[model samples]
Target: MFEQSKKYFSYILNPMELLRTKKVLQVNPTVASPRAEPEEIKIFVFDYNAAQADVRELKTVPECFAFLDSPKTTWLNVDGLRKVDVEKICAHYGIHYLITEDILSIGQRPKMDEIDGLVFCLLNMMYFNEKDSAVEIEQISIVLGKNFVISFQEDAAKDVFNPLRDRLKISGSKVRQNGADYLFYSLIDMIVDNYFVVMEKLGEKIEGLEEDIVRNANTRTLAKINMLRKEMIVLKRSIAPVRELVNGILRSDSDLIEERTEKYFKDVYDHILQANELAENYRDMMMNLNDLYLSNVNLKMNEVMKVMAVVTCLLAPATVIGGIFGMNFENMKWLHTNTTFIIAAFAMIGIPLIMIRIFRKRGWF
Candidate 1:
């Protein structure tokens, strides 16, 4: 009994060495912000009006329900998704279950969905971490209501909407004076602007990969290129949806959106188009790099084969002579004599050297 207890203790201490303990340990999920837990959701309401934009934090879903009908354009910024209370909030605001499902699911493609009296837009905002050589993407969902804009994010961390916040804070910023449409455009414009920053970093990575391939196009370069290609693919997936979404928004007659704000959205729409085009170009360039590396490898292999062929050609005569003399040539007594052996050996040596010179002259070496 004591021995069995000791064995179990040892197994617990060193599970890797124990039998039936082959399952891999699960890694913890990455926490994007301090407020990553589901219980704490921070909701900020900013109502844009002719006088001053009133900004306040809502403590309950009831507060949001009460504040949606004000004459000012209200912006509801919800900063976490784990709160079970969000369902009540969504219900109160008339946001459908499908849209709420999209809010909870992070992997949804960047897209826009609209129903009667609401336009739903999902945008992926990414930040590049150079030290880690990775990018972190967060979902930003915009609910454009009649007199309000509701923005939902996965985690309550730093977001690109701060620029719009600053604009609202200042007296002359476009966000302060414009309707919900301009605020919508400003949020999207901010997102698109940040994308360029990420792309510039991506451009730098592509440049580095180019240099790496030229210097030493090894397996590592191939892997790097594959990684970049995947990232570009994701970028394309994210950007392409917005292209159609923005176009739809532009074409639709949403009474919630003011006519003055169309140009701002068009500006963002053009940027999205440019981003999609750039991603395609990068995809092609990375492919070219892959082809370039393959070509280099083939050339190297050909050089190696050429060297081996030249060496074989030089040694062929020597090999044949040695083989003929090695067997018992008893018919000729001179074959066994020292003088004949020396003569045959010299001929073997001379023949190979002549072959070597011929090959060199022909530039085969």
Candidate 2:
């Protein structure tokens, strides 16, 4: 029964201490391998309201153009920016090279830029799990045209747009009934929702860290706090650029982004503000925990020193008398006497007791 219970408990438990050292070194994209295949970008278009238009992924420039030829609000989602095929597809669609580079870059800051016929936006989509103490960051760049919206994701492995896609799949969502601008809003809104979830997880981590530090200070707890604090710093840095970019979009008179969606973007800006506030608060708490741990260590050390000093003070007189008695003094009468050792021993033992009694009377110990 005990063995069975142990197995059950093991299934339900996670070793957070072990997880604290699971450092995933971020890869540098400057040296990423060049693609050999003929350049072709994949595009997924959702025609929710109209006669189910081409929701097909594009492999050729002609196919990409075919999707863009109609008056339909097309959504071109290109995955895997490492391929020159994506570049060729973007060129065919008249997307700027700088924008393509931004899409390919791993650590592009979140920002929005509108030029001539396009509204370009770069943002981060983050996922965090408190239970696992893990976070993943991905870059998403969106370009809005008069009748189309093209999205470029950093990688193909993960996406936060699934919920938005699911929402659009339903019959009555604004994403389906409205224009491409609405789709843009829906995607951004979903990303922001994920941000909220990540923030909640981060808050839970901070609270748990606080409890751990206050109850039982350990290196593992301190290390976790520092790691979380660094993650918060990175998160804050990623978020700031995006916030400024969102603010720029909110204030701009871009033809691609409608004024009606301004309120929704404003709401996103508010969410960014709240996230920044929470991150700042968590950082402060982490700093305090560090200080508290240092102070506790110092207090423990001082306690040890105090006890040692007390012991030494009580033993000092005894040590001095023993030294005197152990000296060979042939001419000194007291030293020559047989009772000298007894007298010295009595003095050695009695002095410390007397001092201790005095200390006790004064409540020094």
Candidate 3:
């Protein structure tokens, strides 16, 4: 009993051993954010208005101070979370420490909250790893202030906001012509749009996996199905809550969110509702794939068993005749003549052929 208990708990006791022996999932590498530099975190400010927009990178958090109260709408994007830098910057904006903690933490659920003098929105950015067919996630926190929108990202290496960035460069686009609230709306819209992109890739994966299951299902196929099940759960977990977050924004009374911006946020709400539905649809699809895998496996096994049963039946007559004649001291019918051997052989061969014909006629193969 003592040894069995030790065996069960060994993995926890020696994590190094577990790490050495565990099988790691292999796939294309995800884009990972490098650890923040001890001296600085990456910060980019986009200060844009109807006439013109300025895009620049700042070396320190304090540089964002100039845009805080600027009449021109400002977007400050911070990548990589440095505790000191985040605290200082959030402190400057009067963000609550709890909210700052939530911002710096990775893997928070999608949510919206009003804190201090600003409205904060949290989101999870998802990436599909095509090679392994898995889902990877990053956390995003957006703070809408009086005249600026600051986006905090867990990964500095990649995000889905490049199109929004390019639109900021356009001279007369709505993003360029609007206030900070519109910019905030644009940011949320881009993130939700990315859910569709990830879902599209997953849809393609579903098609491919469905084809593979139909053609031939194997243990490898089972593993793939399980992986897709997990990915769907991850997608759903990240996507489902954003609908409520968007709805909350639509209902919020924050002055930072302008009246005109409510329509834009409503558009985001509709997009999220669609995304949530897609996530749910894909989840159901994954379950169907699992059922398909199981049904195909059972069908294959039944085929093997059917062939075995047919072979056994075809040999039964021969077995009975041979066994009856082999008994000691027997006066078996037709056992004394050479023609008897030939007749018995013919009976054995003929009976099986008749059985085969009957089986074929009945379409029982």
Candidate 4:
């Protein structure tokens, strides 16, 4: 787990690698690699009304466009952006190139923008990868229009929208009676709600680290604390912009967002705020854990130093007596008899005992 955390922290430090886009000049257009074959795009289209609903898998962009023309509220979920003709899809939906650029880019900060009758939003979705034992972040871009809502994701391997899908399948679900705007809000809410799950995992790791620090303060424990601190920093960076994005949506005057839907967004906005607060609390706890670990190590060092000082003090008088007796001066009285050696031995042992008693009385030990 510690090794996984270290690897993830390194990735967070250099997040550009996650995007795989390179800009050659200051004003040059960004270029992406075309070497790798793109994964086959899977499209899920849902046409639903107040009473009934239809869900289908679209094989081509034409199918997606045809589904958009339906009278019912249409939801087009495009999974896997690689090797797909994104330009044609954006053209069909009236999405601007800038918005498509943000969609294709992997490392975009969470943001909301309105342009030409479309509400464009970029969000970061987080989930814990149990197999890897690390937090994984992916960008989810949403485009909301008058009659339809489209979503783009980088990978189709994992998604947090399954619950929302289930809710849509039920006839009496709140999402069934609402329009496309509500569906957009529902999608955002689902993404934000998963933040709590990631935070819960992070909270668990923080508590575990706290317990470990108290029980066995060592270099490994210190390393784990620092790794958790890095993870929290990355999480905070990811969530802070999302709060601003949601706040912007709440205050937006865009026609794509209805007045009724604004209240739902406000709820999501509150969730983001809560997530940020929890992250801040975790960050502060990590710092405190680090300080506690250092204090424990310093305390141990001080104890060792105290013992060495006492031992040195007790041996000082014996060293002086030995030095005086080894001198060549014949006038020394104790050096003329065997009693001198015996008395010297007694003094060596007796003086240290007396000093030890003095030290004990003074509470030095």
Model 2: per-residue lDDT, tens digit, 16-135? Answer: 433433423343546643433424445676644544444565555456666666677778787756456667767877888887777666665688887667788888888785555766
**Most lDDT-accurate candidate:** 3
TM-score per model over all chains: 0.81, 0.78, 0.89, 0.87
What is the C-alpha lDDT profile of model 3 across 1-365, one tens digit per residue?
98677645765765643442232222222333234444457999899888999999998778887786798888999987788888988988888998897887645678999887688999988788776566777889999988888898867666988988999999989889888888888888888898899999999999999999999999778767766777777788789999989998888988888797788888888899899888888989998999999999999999999999999999998988778776675677767878978877888899999999999999999
**How many clashes (backbone N, Cα, C below 3 Å) per candidate?**
0, 2, 0, 0
Instruction: Give the TM-score comparing model 3 with the true structure, all chains together.
Output: 0.89
lDDT of 4 by residue, 1-365 (tens): 99789756855975643332121111222654333436578888888988988998988877777765788888888887853567678888888988987877756668999888788889888987665335678889999998799999867777888888898899999999999999999999988888889989988887888888778788678757756665676678678898988898888888778798888998998999999998888888888998999988898899999999888998998999899898999788868897999998899999999999998999888
Which residue window of length 10 is worst by lDDT in model 4?
A: 20-29
> Residue 108 of candidate 1: its Cα lDDT?
66
Q: Sort by lDDT, best first: what order?
A: 3, 4, 1, 2
Q: Global lDDT of each model?
A: 0.76, 0.72, 0.83, 0.81
Error (Å) of candidate 2 at residue 188 is: 1.9
Model 1 score (lDDT) = 0.76
Instruction: Report lDDT (Cα) of residue 194, candidate 3.
Output: 87
In terms of TM-score, which candidate is strongest?
Answer: 3
lDDT of 1 by residue, 1-365 (tens): 99689667766875633432221122232422233557677889887676787789987767888876788888988888764766777788898998887776645667777886788888788877786455557878888887788888866565877767877877777677778877777777888788878888888999988888888777667757766776676566666787887888898787877787888788888998898888788778888888888987788789989988877876788788778877886795667677987888798889888888887899876
User: Model 2 clash pairs?
Assistant: 39-85, 40-85
- The true-versus-predicted C-alpha distance at residue 329 of model 1, in Å, is 0.8
Residue 290 CA displacement from its true place in model 1, Å: 2.2
Those runs of model 3 whose alpha carbons end farther than 4 Å from true positions after fitting are 1-39
